[model samples]
Target chain A: MNMIEAAAVHVRFGDRVVLESVDLAVAEGEFHGVMGPNGAGKTTFFNVLTGRVKPNRGRVLLAGEDVTGLSPHRIAAKGIARSFQIMTLFDEFSALDNVMMGLPEFRARSHDVARAAAGDSRFAAKSSEALAAVGLADKGDIRAKDLSYGDRRALEIAVALAQAPRVLCLDEPTSGLGSDGVQRLAALIARLKGRLTIVAIEHDMEFLFSLADRISVIHWGQVVARGTPHELQQNEWVRRSNLGKFA
Target chain B: MAAPLLVLDDVRKVYTRGRVIRRPTFTLQANLSLDEPDIVGVVGPNGAGKTTLFEMMTGSNAPTSGRVLVAGTDIHGVKYRERDRLAIHYHQSYQVRRFRKRIPSAFLAPSPTRTPLVHLFDEPQFNLQDGYIGFMLDFFRKLRDEGRLVVLCMHPTAAWHLDILAEIAGRFLFVAGGGVTAVANFGALVADPRCRSYLGPEMTKAADAICHGAVHSST
Candidate 1:
């Protein structure tokens, strides 16, 4: 069954049409990639899916339930966790503390889970596991503020992963990292491939091609093409419209 | 070389929990200097004292030992008004609560207008949206364009703002449990195409180390 489905969705930002009759679906354990240019409304689509923004029309279903107008936190509680394209993190707190905040649901799951794991043991175990998965286990304790630009982007993914969501949505996960950082993040996502449903919006064609099982191209707020990576690489319209320069 | 924009000399912080006390000392013995714009990443474990280092540098909290100097001025020993003029510390959380309560009252009070030279941001990404994010980006951009230094205490996730941040400060330091491990020039890490993906593992490790170090060191 599809974890998330958006059908005939329309969204506007003060009359600027961001999405029009959009249809998208994320199946369980599927890694779907959303590709587009800067103003293509990739982030807006994510916002709509996660209930951060309300769509003017159409219905959004999460696990077969209508969740079009729910709040972001509520959607997150329903098993959708997102990492910002612009990178969002708690600066003053240590990286571990930031990761701990992502586990509010898990923290609420048990009382002893909070007090007994206040130190770096349980939190470290889970946070470090997520960090190590992303190749950031070594820097877990460093203040989020102290990381390099690239490292910060990776840390955001780690924070999202710590939430242990059923559906993980990432916006521009590799916007500001080096080659090594990109490879590591790709590998990290690859590791999570079969375990979680992922919807990634990216401008980096190479990264998307490497990680995405299915690629959907959005242009001017519409899905111009949807196919396997091979199919996308061979699509003439996709090449002309979005992949022309990159391909 | 010119003196560092900020310097920490024999900085020490000791926290006591009940009857237990733990004190960690950090030293920057070598002359650390920033002659031009650069982006530096400080990488270490949690307890390595990154926040404490920032507190000492921004003059929010005093070091048990040593001194923090900004622009060659001793911040801890300086008068309150003088310190306010030199730097402003931005907490991780906007403390919307405090802003709602204190800022307006302070503004209405007979306090002198404060324009901080260094804008310290703890978690700059916390509760940030399009408008506020744009405001912060523009604010720092103006400072950077005008050649001012802004120190950011940010998480790895929010590091995407580093490009704009570097445009302003041009230099960065990565502080972890072990102290400043990596210092890079401006656009050094961001300019690379692959740096974005590689960040995941590096940040995870650095954060892990700091948290582990902090907990153990504190205990």
Candidate 2:
């Protein structure tokens, strides 16, 4: 069954139409990638899915329920979670505290950070489970500020996992990561795939191709192509869009 | 020898959020100098301080230690208005309006009346369309023609721009963990472990990936 779907989505800012009649569908437990050239309204599509940017007209369905036009907080409550291109963690907090802050119960989860709690066993257990899921099991005590860049990103995902989201959205999760970092993240995503419906916007086509079961290419704010990795590679427009660079 | 047009003498920037919660901290630790009008490709993974370098150059954030020099004058010592005129940082969005009316002066030629200037652009690939990418590349070349220094900062995602810049960019400055490491050209860049290791697979490949239009340019 399609866990998430967008129908005829249209989003615009003033005279600029960022997203035009965009449609996307993701099956349950599927890893979906979004690829586009720069300024293709890819970011807007991301925002629309996360409920951060409400489409001027359209419908967003999360598990067959209407989620369009909802605030990011409401969407998070609906089991949708997102990590940012920029680190949104409270730098001063410990890894455990950071993950705890990502729980839906821990204040809305709109990248609006909640104060880190010193010792809450209940939150600690939940956050620990999350940290372990992302392989940061022993690093929970380390401050978010002190974690290595790769670990910090993992912690961010752990935070999202703590929410127990059905659908997790990663915005350029590997943008700043090194080769080792990229491999580490790819491994984490690989392990998490069957358990979560994952949607990612990635510029690194290699990472996207290796991890995404299916991908949809957005151009001019519309999804011009959607198919398996092999199909996308065969696409003329995707090829001309410099898909060769990634190869 | 005339001093370099730009210099960072052990520059550092620190942040202190709360007295009890967080102590003082430093994010940027830059120590480098550049003299030529080389088209320097500023690249690193995210959080590598590529943007911070531009910020320090534009005088938006004052470094906690050391100095930033443009034409031998300390940018930190000058008022923001003066720094604004000297250091122009162009982000990807037109809404920024910070450096609106920005042109390719450095790539081509300066106004002749103004002092020799440096234009710092962070991720100029944003919002660009299909045909316009080449246009922007040509514009930067024009700036180079005019005898201005251009620092083109690109995130790994936009590393494809490196292929285009490589043909013209005389140097590649790899920023990792806030420090600066410079390579002579694209040949040295891909060969250096720093460039390959720091960038993701696509960007690493792009370090040597030549734009089709300029296949012989040697990325």
Candidate 3:
């Protein structure tokens, strides 16, 4: 059964139609990639999936249960967690504290997240496990700002992982990373591929094409094309362009 | 027998400057009928009123004179918020122009359909590297096959851009100097002297190559 589905999603801001009719169905444990040019309504579609923006029409289903128009916090609690394209980590907080702050248990228990992270053993263990999943277990003591750019990205993923979400929605995870950073991130994503359902919007075509089980090309606020990486690259124009070089 | 998909019945739009003097700065006129489901390519130079023409077609900007019909329903007469049900305009960035409402939405007629009959894309950016061009072209065909009129307005800067326009569009509308000229096919569009001038030397050569069946034979 499909884990997350957006059916005929339509979003319009005033007279401008942002997403015409976007339909996507990501199966359980599948790595789905969403790629599109800038201003193609890719982010808006992400927003709709994660409940940041509600569609003017259509439905978003989570495991056959309708979850459209739910609040962001409600959606997050329902096992859909997301990381932002622009990093949202607290610069002054330790990596562990950031992850702990994301833990639902920790958030529910105390409003003082920084203090609670250090005092609570269960929360600390859970945060450490999340950090280890993203290869940041040893770097938990360091402040987010002190970590390398790559480590910071990993830490952000760790924060989302702390939620133990069923579906992880990543927005431009590979952005602002060097070649080495991208490779590390790819390996991390590879490790988590089968264990978790992932939906990523990425500009790094090679990264997405390599890791994604199936990819959807979004343009004009709609899913313009979709297929496996090999199937998509078979287009004559794609073969002529740099994207074909990946194959 | 069924109402034509889209019809611009002698539509005219005039943008005038100076509220008191009301001197006309720009004017665009179009009279055409797309009776069937097909992808119609729109090409023209900058400030040739392509954007204005799209606005009028989608009912965002009211025509100064005539009617813009989508499957026999006059879009201007439709409810303000529900106008998109008849025709939707995907603007470039946040270039959505706001026009004054002449009549209250309660007085306007409701849209006859749920989905837009006329889809007008204004200069949608087509990037080649990501390989989304193929998908977009296919989507245009899908909309056409669903019995909808798809109007694509593009500013052809590259050779491949012209290739895409030639390949995807069954007909062409060359908008220039406030007038719209409809061409039946790609070969005819390239043959017109005004279109040649608008395309420039490099693009014109590419367009001619496409017309002679010398390019993009792969698909």
Candidate 4:
């Protein structure tokens, strides 16, 4: 069964249709790649699938369960988590605190200064473990503001991973990182490949081509092409679109 | 593989602020290891500790914790003048040149010279004519050809040598607010989505173009 699927999903903002009856599906444990030009409804598609947007028509499903029109929080309860294109870390909090907030169980309680400050606590241990998984274990005590851009992104991913989602959707996951930052993030994502079902919207042709096991090109809010990287690389239509230059 | 020319192991620097209530600050923390002839390109947003890492590598600033070795020599324990035997620091004038970071007036206009195993170019492109940048790039490349490690520290906003570095450098060290992460080599670096994400779209696009052209030349 597909991990996540959007069947003929349609979304419109006022008179303009952002996603025009789009369809996308991520297989179980597959590194499904989504690529397209700017304003092509890539993020809007993600929003519809994650429950941030209620599609004008069609249904969304996760692991064979219908999730269409569910509020974001409700869908999240159904095990879907996503990272934003912008840096979503709390600048004032330490790396540990940021990941701790990602924990689904911990986010319910009131903010606790004492627990956040205590390094040896269970919450801190869980937070630190998540950070360690992303190669930021040593940066747990450092304020997120002090972290490098790469480390901040790593912390962001740590936050997402801590949620223990069955389906993780990444929107332009590697958008703001430098060469070094990109490699580190790719390494982390590569490690997460077989363990988690990820749908990444990436514009970096080189990174996306190598990272995604199956490629899907979205344009004008539609799934224009879907296949292996080799097939997409040779698609005449993809070669004529904005992706043509990069492919 | 060639013997590692630069090794920074769990390096950390702490600073004290607030005269009324001063506490140690963790200003820099980096763990990087690179081999000889590696043109290590370091770039990040302002306050990312790119310069300080150069300083630490050059023995100008002592790390609060961890070790910095050049050609297998621990630089912090060495004498001041003797320090240059392995590294030279070309300081940059940041927008806010904190009192301590003030590059002595005499050293402000100093030119880069090849005298050490590692050359630290801290904002070398600052206050220079366009022509000098090309010269500096060639200078950096020449030293790399001679098996020296050239660590170029660039400001995020400044017009960096994005194409040149992408075409030549083998490794990249990204420092954000003092913490550092290593990207193994140029090929692996370019294929990272974060390259476009963290470095911004324009620069990453330019680097991708440059890397594409370089593949032909390198082959």
TM-score value, chain A, candidate 2: 0.92
Fraction of true interface contacts that also occur in model 1: 0.00
Return the DockQ of model 2. Answer: 0.02
State which candidate, 2 or 4, has the greater TM-score.
Answer: 2
TM-score of each: 0.50, 0.53, 0.94, 0.51
Q: Encode model 3's per-residue lDDT on B1-219: one tens digit a residue.
A: 999988999999998999899999999999999999999999999999988889888888999999988999999999988888888887766787788998999999999888888888888877776566777788899999999899999888888788889889999899999999999999999999999999899989989988787765333
What ranges in model 4 sit over 4 Å off?
Answer: A113-120, A236-247, B1-219
Highest TM-score, which number? Answer: 3
| DockQ values of all predictions | 0.01, 0.02, 0.58, 0.01
The residue-by-residue lDDT of candidate 1 on B33-133, one tens digit each, is: 44332223332335556666666666556665677766667776555433544555544333311111222323332212233445455555522221123
Q: Rate the local accuracy (lDDT) of all candidates.
A: 0.63, 0.74, 0.90, 0.73
Higher-ranked by TM-score: 2 or 3: 3
lDDT of 3 by residue, A69-178 (tens): 99999999999999998999999999999899998878889997657866988888999999999999899999999999999999999999999999999999999999
lDDT tens per residue, model 4, A165-230: 899888887888899888988899899998999999987777888889987767545565677877
* Candidate 2 local lDDT, B81-167, one digit each (tens): 345446666565563423222323233322222333677767765332232344345445655666667788766556545555665
Which is better, 1 or 2, measured by TM-score? 2
Q: What DockQ does predicted model 3 obtain?
A: 0.58
Q: Which candidate, 2 or 3, has the higher DockQ?
A: 3
lDDT of 4 by residue, B1-219 (tens): 554788998998878887998786757888878876868877676666776777788776777789998877787766544465577665532432322333333433221222468876666542222122333455577678878888877644422355556655668877675678788875566567655576787766656666676431210
Task: State which candidate has the highest DockQ.
Answer: 3
Candidate 3 stretches with Cα past 4 Å from truth are: B15-26, B216-219
